[model samples]
Each structure stands twice: as structure tokens, then as C-alpha cells.
Target: MGNQPMIVMSEDSQRTSGDDAQSMNITAGKAVAEAARTTLGPKGMDKMLVGSSGNVVVTNDGVTILQEMEIEHPAANMIVEVAQTQEEEVSDGTTSAVVVGGDLLGQAEDLLDQDVHATSIEQGYRQASEEAKAILEEQAIDVGADDTELLEQIAATAMTGKGAENAKGRLAELVVDAVTSVADDAGVDTDNIKIETVVGGAIEDSELVDGVVVDKDRVSDAMPYFVEDANVAVIDDALEVAETEIDTEVNVTDPDQLEEFLDREQEQLRAMVDDIVDAGADVVFAEDGIDDMAQQFLADAGILAVRRTKSSDAAQIARATGAQVVGNVGDIEADDLGFAGTVSQQSVGGSQQLVVEDVEDASSVTLLLRGGTEHVVDEVERAIGDSLGVVRITLEDGKALPGGGAPETNLALELRDFADSVGGREQLAVEAFADALESIPRTLAENGGLDPIDSLVDLRSQHDAGQSSAGLDAYSGDVIDMETEGVVEPLRVKTQAIDSATEAAVMLLRIDDVIAAGDLKGGQIDGDDGGDDGGPPAGAGGPGGMGGMGGMGGGMGGMM
Candidate 1:
């Protein structure tokens, strides 16, 4: 008895179990979801995030806002991953996915409060998710890659809420053209579809380039401004004279010998240009530097040359021009050269860019994106990216669905009927899932400044009457047939959103315990040590500074 001693736990290791942990997790997850919810739909409001450095971001992009937040809680980080996965998979619908995830947790929390088992709620959600996928597949409309009008509608749908909304028509045309030009029977490779942004002109000036554009200038002013029907040579080797691999010293004491040495180097450089000229190459894209003498010779020979081109751009040019990248100048043959109608230098946005245009049988293409400012340019890029992703997914799956919350309303109305057949404590969860799904349209209505309940009630009534395509029109604050209105989204986007959100929510709901190690520098939880570097703003959380330590009040603010 005397040798037995009591053990004490250190405060550094903190643990929360049962209801406390679940409540904290639910609250955190919901906060993250609410952070992005307001940014959903066409009429969604933009968030003005001001960083500690006074840098401001005014955006409605879910991924961007989530990424900009500073979240530290582990549970909240998991919720952030849902948004990131949505972005990675579809490049759109991030906000909707997060909102649905939050709503699911909110519903589950209510079920937990009612003494319903977490396992039952999770099972119900999983079942509803599977059912949602089936509904999406059954209701989806078929689309082909060649359907230009529908593709434009898809593109315009993606850009409706953002900065590119004003120029969506012109931008959609450019996106479709660029995507189709680079697409073959196999599939669309977005890598071949490059978006080059220049912040100077209006979005209307944005156009598609048949070939690649590199932000590079010609090697010398003496070179021709433009080369037509040019024989393009892509040299990976340097134009400078090669030095001996083994280090050696040439001690030339005689003046004539030194002059001979200098002349030999000049001749070597000149010979390199001679070799390129002999290959019948009229344009040179050197992956490495071109010597001064070689540049002069190429200019005198009327060969347009760009030195030190990026390796990726070099390969892109090769693909577009049907040229081979030559490692040695001596081995460059006529067949190694590529053909391009014009290779010219143009000044864009106060910088020189080498424009390689009108290549025969080109496989690669570029979208020259121009906008009024940097912010507009960034937002425009995001819009085009979303369009490309949507188009690619639609082409691959050959399916699309009506947008403007029609799919959500349809899923909700159908889920309730399915819930009746479920018939268990799980049925409550299914019904809850149905209710959760309606939050999308409700939030959309609210963001559009309409009465959310009224809009949702009207939507539910329409869907009940067999109006499958009925959806909230944010612009007019009325429910309309999305299909007739030309509002559509990729089936993959909807299905993926449901799967990702449900999976994340289920994972969060199953957790009933949390153990965290307190700060090593101090004994407090999340407390700053005296050595705080002030790297990121103190208020910012990891992904979304949505958690303000305000407990319930802060969480509610995030939802609104």
C-alpha cells in the first residue's frame, strides 16, 4: 500500500468525449459550410476577405474563400477537405457541396439530440446519397461534345455568378472553341488547352489562338518581325561554342595565337547558325541561350529566333508545329523542322509575347484571356476553368442535368417518398436528409434577396406537381423550368457533390471523441506563446477563419 501511488494526467493532453465532442465537431463542420454557403448560386453575395497585410479578396468562389480562411481545429479541417475535393473533382459546385455537408451535420445533430443513433443517421445518409446518384442519372439529359449551343449554356451557367458574367457570351464562345480545337476522339486533355491572361483589354478581346503563345521576345532586334511559312527548329542544345568536358588551360602568349583563338570561337558560333540555316530552318526556338555571334548570324540570315524558351512552351510549339526538338545542331535535318504560317512578336500587357499562329494540323491551342484588371483576370480564369472542367466531364459522361437548384428540389421531393419506404429510425434520417437537400434552394433564394421559405415552398409545390425541371430563377426570384431556360450543369458535378458531401458528413458524424495535445510552448489550448511570429492573421483559421471562438453565436453568423 505504501509503494502504490496515484497517477495524474497532464493538462497538455486534453480529451472531449460523447456529446461534447460531437457537438463541437458538428458546430465546426456547420461553420465551415456556412462560410461558403452564401457564395452559392448566381445571386450569391461575394465575400470581401481582408488579410492582415491589407490585401483584399472580393470573390464568390467557394474554393477560394475556403482556401483563404485560417482554420486550426482538426474537425473543421476535415470539412475544408470536402470543399477541396469538390474543387479538385469538378472545379465547380464547391459551395453547394459544402453547404449540403453542413446541412447534413446540422440535421444529424438534431437527430442525435432526439436520441437517434449516429449509426442510423449515417446509414440513412449513405442510402440517400446512393438514391441521389440514381436520381441524377435517371433525370440527366444526354449531351454531345459537338453540341455548341448547349455547351455555351453550360459555360454560361458556370460563369453566371462571377466577374465574367458581363462577358459570359463572348467568353463561352472562346472556351468552347478552345476546348473543341484541342479535343480529339480519345478525350479532352485540358493540359493542351492553355489559358493565357493579360490584364489590359476588355474581356471581349479574349480570343482563342490556334497555336501556343509564350511570353518571350525575339533574340535580337535585327531579326524579322514576322516569319511566314516558316521552317521551325526547336534546339535543346546551346548555340554557344562547346567547351572541353575536361578542364584545361590554353596559355596563348602570342598575340596572333590569342586572335586566332577568338576568331575560332566566333567561327564556331557562326557555324552553328550556318548549320541551322543549312537545315532550311527559318525560325529558331532555343531551349538554351544563343551566343551573340550566332544571334547576329541568324538575324542576318532572316531567321526569327527566340532564345531560352521554357521547356513546356518548347514542347507545346513542337506539338503545334509538327517540329522535332533537336539536341544537336549538326543532326538537324529538313524533316526535323516544323511548319507555321506566322511566328511573330507582339507586345501584350506591357510585355513582349511570342505568338506562334496558324500551324497546319495543330494539336495544341491557347485561350488568350484579357480582362480590365488583375482581379477580373483571375476571376475570368476561374470561370473558364470551371467551364472547361464542366465540358470535359459532360463529354466524358455524356450526361447533364438542369441547374438553378432544380436537381436539389427534385432530389428532396423524391427522397421524402423514398423515406416513407425506408420505415425505421433511419427513416427519420432519410427525411432529415430530404430536408437538408432543400437548404440549397433555400440558401439560393436567400442569397438572391427573396424569401427563402416562400421560394422553397413554391418550388416544393411545383416539384410535387410533376414539374421535374422547375427551379429558382435567382435573377427574377421566381421558380422556372431550368431546362427551358437553358440552365444546366454536368451530371458529374451533381453526383460528385452529393457523394463528397455525404461522405464527409458521415465521417464527421461518426466521431464522438477528440483528443488534442495542448501547446508545447504553453499549457493552454491554442494559446499563443510569447514567440508568435504573426505569420498569418490571428483571426484566420486554417481554411476558413469561420471559427471565431464565439461558440454558438459565431457559428450562426457563418450560416447566414
Candidate 2:
């Protein structure tokens, strides 16, 4: 027989379960946080994550990274949720949240080595978390009107790219002002606001216009270029022209036949156009159909118009402007539309747009967007949306607390004290939570590349000296004191988040060897399939999660 090389492979698969789960969770949480920890401050760098599908994303945003990752481990997903919760609660502490969560595991690991039971550690963690939050609040720096400049600095911190620094700074101010403007004793209108743009593409003048610019010509010949005390009408629902279909059969290509058909169509269109203009509609947004002849007639009648509009947009305009769509131009009435005392028309970039003031009230503000390229405008729009939608909501809900890592540092100490107060297994979990909370300022210091020990010492000293801005000792760290306003979470939300996260961690950590310890441990097979549970589970968390559950008793299995 010819000589052949023998190959050997390990026969036993290393089943990561029980304590392995907790350990893995600690590892993954730390890994994910370390991946983004460097991008904490303004000088923080970006990460380029190339997905299996060849998709590329370069960002240090914790939420984005968690979302983009095709995470397989259940414990890693927990880390992602922690980041999400932090972002939701504070809008600016996601990186800190995750890093601290990892740190808690690290500390817990040490405690475990000392032979501390999982139950005891959990109990301690709970107590510590409570203490930490209290400390954070008490030690927080007051950011009053004097710190307005700091707000700008913080906004700049969030911005990137070419105009990011400048735009973000100005935008931060605008955000404060806009928020303040709409905020009565009640609050800002966080849900409803509008932004629009128009381009003069087809006209001789190619340029940019701001503030609800539209590219259509004004309708009618007799209307004033600037109609002061003009009533406004927004037509969104129906064209209200002729419901009757133009079903007539005309076989003749002759000029006379064509003329007859055209005349009938023109008459029908004119009737509809005339109705709206006569109804005192100085402005019209037609969501549906409108013929060229009818538009020309309205122009002749001096009516401002936008043709072929999106129905949703048209409806909003009507709601905002208090206008209606008349069935025919001849049937217009004054009361159906909104009253705008001052109506101004401007033609920029070959586009004609009407600015209506005092439509329903004077508080309405529209941001006019102008750009030389579509990409610029698009990016600007996205930036504005992100700020308004995600960032603003987060701030509004979190009470817009101040920045500078003060609250975090204070909270950490409080957690340490709280853990000391609690007893039993619950204390272990609480201690973990508290330890995680305290890690924020340290991470910030680390990210800033500051001498953490010195910075922390200075921070404590500043607090003792009543510097008003000092909390933890990171005052001397290379970090900016943006707006450190008092941002408080509603008790309900705060409780829910903490409860859900801690519960998930504990419950998941309780399993040992999923197959060996599960109900189907004794070679229990499905009626049809040979696999346990009749199938090999589905989605991300199946038997895989249960396998790690064994770590619960040891405080390591749940780490998955």
C-alpha cells in the first residue's frame, strides 16, 4: 500500500454554556465597547465596518454599530440594548453605557474569583445602582442661562464633516431657540413641524431659494405681487373639477374635430380653476390633476399655485394654512380658506413661492433650504431630521441635563454607597448596575487620553471647592463643558429600562448546559424530527441562549 499522511481533528466541540455564557458576555460587551470607546470625544476617530454583504459604514455611534452588526451571541445583543437604553435615556451616553456594562462584568469576575456567590453579587449591584443615580443628581452642575455658550460647544462636538462644526454650533443655538420659541408653560411642539424647498430648474435663473420655495408661476393676471392682508387657500383633497370621464369617441384627426375636443376639455378645466381663485384662494396646492389651460387661466386670475403635489404634503399645508380646494374656479368662497393678512411672493432661481405669515398663528417658522447641489441639500435635510427627530426627542425626554461628565462621576460614587446598603443575591446585580453607571466619566477621561487618576482627583477637588461645574475629577481632562443642564428621566421610563435590562441579564444567565439541562435532555426527539424541541430552534436566541443560561449560578453563563 502507498504511504498516506494521517490527519487529525478535535472530536469534542467546545460548548460555550453556563459560566461560559457570563464570561462570553463580558468579553463581547467589552469588545463592542472597545470598538467604539476611542470615538467618545470630538477628537474620537471613526470605525469602518465592512459587512459580509460588502456594505461599508464608518461611524463611532454605538447605536449604529449595534444595528449594523450581524451579532450572533445573545449576550452581545444585551450589550447593544444597553447602549440603546443609554442613548434613549440621555442621548449622549451610549458609549459610556456599554463600556460600563462591560466593566461591571469585569469587576463581577473578580468578585467571583474571591468565591462570592452570584446571588450575593446581584443583590449588591442593585443597591449600588440606586446609590449611584442619587449621587449623580446631587452632584450635577447647574447649567443656567450663563451656559448658553456651552450649548453651542456641545452641539459642535456632535457635528462632523465640512460644515459640521459651524452648522452644528449654529444649529444647536437654533434648536434651543426653536425649542424655547414653541415652549409655553406646556412645552415645545416636539411632534409637528415642517420644512420645504423649491428649485428654479426650468427657468432662466438657476439659483437657490429659501423658506417654502416653489417652482410654479403665480396664477391670474390681476393679483398683487405682494398681497397684504390676503387670505390663503390650500387645495389638497380633490381637484373637484369634472368627475365625469371624457369618454367621447372622436375618430377624426382633422383640425375641426381636434379643436372641438380641446375646447370641451379647456372649458371643464377652466370652470374648476375659476372656482378656486374666486373662493379667495391666493395660494393653491393641487394634489391631483390640473390641465395646462386651467393653470394659465388661474395665472391670468392672479392665483399662486403648486401643481401635482403629494397628497400628504398638500393635506399638511392645508391644515397649517387653513385653506380648502374649491370644486370649480367660479364657486370660490372666502371662508373656506385660511386667512393670511400678509402674503409675499418672491421668484428665486426661476421658482415662484408665496410666503404666508399669520396663517393660523405667528409662531410658525419654516427653515428655507438652499444649495448648489442636490447632495448638499439632501445631507442638510438628513442632518436636520436626525437632530429634530432623534436627538431632540431624546433630550426632551431626558430633561436636557448638562454635559461635562459631572452627573456620571457623581452617580458612580453613589452606586458604591448603595451597594453597601443592600443584602443577599439582589445586591450582586445592583452592584453591577451601579458599577456600570460609574464608568462613564472614566471612559470619557480615557477617551480624552487624560491622566485618569489626576483628572479624577481634580474633579473631586473642584466639587469640594464648589466650582459649580465640578462633579467627578475629570474637570482637568481634555473635555469641553458643553451644556450640562439638568436632564431628568420620567420615573416610569427610568424604572422600566433598568428593570428590563437587569431582568433579561439575570434570567438569561440562569441556564447551564442547554441540552443537558433542558426539558429534552434525555435524547428527547420530536415526533417527526430527530432534533430537540422537534427543531433546532429559530432566529438568534434559541438553544444557544439557554446553553449560556448555566452561567447564571456562577454569574458567568448569562454573559452570552
Q: Number of the top candidate by lDDT?
A: 1
Candidate 2 wrong stretches, greater than 4 Å: 1-17, 20-31, 47-61, 68-92, 101-126, 137-163, 166-169, 195-227, 237-260, 308-316, 323-336, 341-358, 368-401, 425-431, 457-468, 471-560
Per-residue accuracy of model 2 over 163-209 as CA lDDT, tens digit each: 23335655555544544444444544533345554332321111222
Inter-residue clash pairs, candidate 1: 69-543, 69-544, 70-540, 70-541, 70-542, 71-541, 71-542, 71-543
Off by over 4 Å in 1: 1-12, 50-56, 235-261, 264-268, 271-275, 278-280, 324-337, 347-351, 517-560
* C-alpha lDDT of residue 270 in model 2: 74
Cα-based lDDT at residue 66, candidate 2: 57
Worst 10 residues of 1 by lDDT: 520-529
State the lDDT of candidate 1 residue by residue for 246-293, as single tens digits.
999999999999999999999988888889999999999999998888
List per-prediction Cα lDDT, in the order shown. 0.83, 0.50
The Cα error of candidate 1 at residue 144, in Å, is 2.1
Error of 2 at 22 (Å): 4.2
